[model samples]
Target: MTGKSLSERIGDLGRRLAVEAHTAWLAARDPRVAWFARLLAVAVAAYALSPIDLIPDFIPVLGWIDDLVILPLGLLAVRRLIAAPLWSELHALAETASERPSSRAGMILILLIWAALLAIVYWAVRTSPLH
Candidate 1:
C-alpha cells in the first residue's frame, strides 16, 4: 500500500496536473516545440481559459462535458504530442500559478443559465393549452 494518505495523494495529483497544464501553455510559445504541437497546446490553453463552452454546464449529467471530457482529452493529446525531454524540462520548472488566468467564466455561466431559463419559459408558453 502507498504510504501517503488520500488527501496527500490527491494534492500531489493536483500539483502534477497543474504542472502539466502550465507546461502546455508555456510550450505553445516556445520555438523549439514543433508548430503543430504548439498549435495544439495553444488550443488546449485557450479552451481551458474560454468560458464559451461547447456544452452548457446547466444541463444534467452532461454539464461537465468540457471539464470532465474535453479538457482531459486535450491535455492527454498535448501530453502525447509533446516530446518526453521537453515535458521533463518544463515539469522540473513547474509553477502552478495561484490566480486564474482568465476573467470570463462567472459572467458566461450567468448568461447561459438565464438563456436556458428563457428558452424553457418560451417553450412552455408556446406549448401551453391556454394559448
Candidate 2:
C-alpha cells in the first residue's frame, strides 16, 4: 500500500482531475487538437467544471462512483485521444495556469437546463391524477 492516507490520496486525485479538466478546456479551444478530440474535450471540460452531475451525490455509492470513475475515465479518454506532444504541452500550461477559469456561459446553460427539467416535472405533477 502507498504511504499516503486515504484522504490524502483522494485530495491528490481531485487536484490531478482538476488539472486534466483544465487541459481539456484548453484543448477544446485550440485549433491544433484533432476535431474529434476537441469535441470530446469540450464535453469533458464542461462536465468536470459544472456543479451538476449526471448522478446526484445524495444517492449512496453510485453518485460518488460517477464522479470518481466516469470523470477519470473521460479524462483518460481525452488524454489518449490527444497526441503525446500536444497533451504534454497542454498539461504543462494547465499546471502553470494560476487563475482557474470560470465560464458564465456554462453556468447559464446549466441553469437553463435545470429550469427546463423543473418545468417538465411541474407539468407532470399538475396533470397527474394521483396529485
Candidate 3:
C-alpha cells in the first residue's frame, strides 16, 4: 500500500495533535464559531491539561478507557461540529506556532477558579440548610 508507515503515522499524530490544540485555542475566541463549539473547544483544552481524569490511570482497564476511548471520541465530535474553513485556518496558525506558548497567568487563573469553587462548597456545607 502507498499509505504511511508506522513511524510516519506516529509523527503525523504528533503534528495533528498540535494542530488540533491550536484549533481549539482559536475556536475558544473566534466569534464565527457557535457558542457551544467555543465551549467544547475550551473544555477539550481543559481536559487535556487536567491531571485528574474521568477514570484515573491507576485503575486497570477502565482507567485507560477514558483516555483512549472517551477523549478521542469527544475530540472527534468537536471536529465534526467545527467548520472546515475555520479548522484549516486554525491548523495553519498552529503549524506556525512550532514553539508552544507559555501561560503562567492562565495557570494562576485556573487555580483561583478552583479555589473559589472550593470555598463556596465549603461555606455551603458548613451552613447547610438541611442540617
The TM-score between candidate 2 and the true structure equals: 0.71
Model 1 misplaced stretches (Cα beyond 4 Å):
1-17, 96-131
TM match of model 1 to true structure:
0.58
lDDT string, candidate 3, 76-128, tens digits? 76778788888788767867786578799999999999999999999999899
Ranking by lDDT: 2, 1, 3
Which of the numbered candidates is closest to the native, going by highest TM-score?
Answer: 2
lDDT of 3 at 62: 92
lDDT of each: 0.80, 0.93, 0.79
Please write out the lDDT profile of model 1 over residues 24-116, one tens digit for every residue: 888898888889999999988787767778888798778776667788788889878888898777656656353436568888999999999
The TM-score of predicted model 3 comes to 0.59
Q: What 10-residue stretch in candidate 1 is worst by lDDT?
A: 91-100
lDDT score, residue 93, model 3? 80
Tell me the TM-score of each prediction against the true structure.
Answer: 0.58, 0.71, 0.59
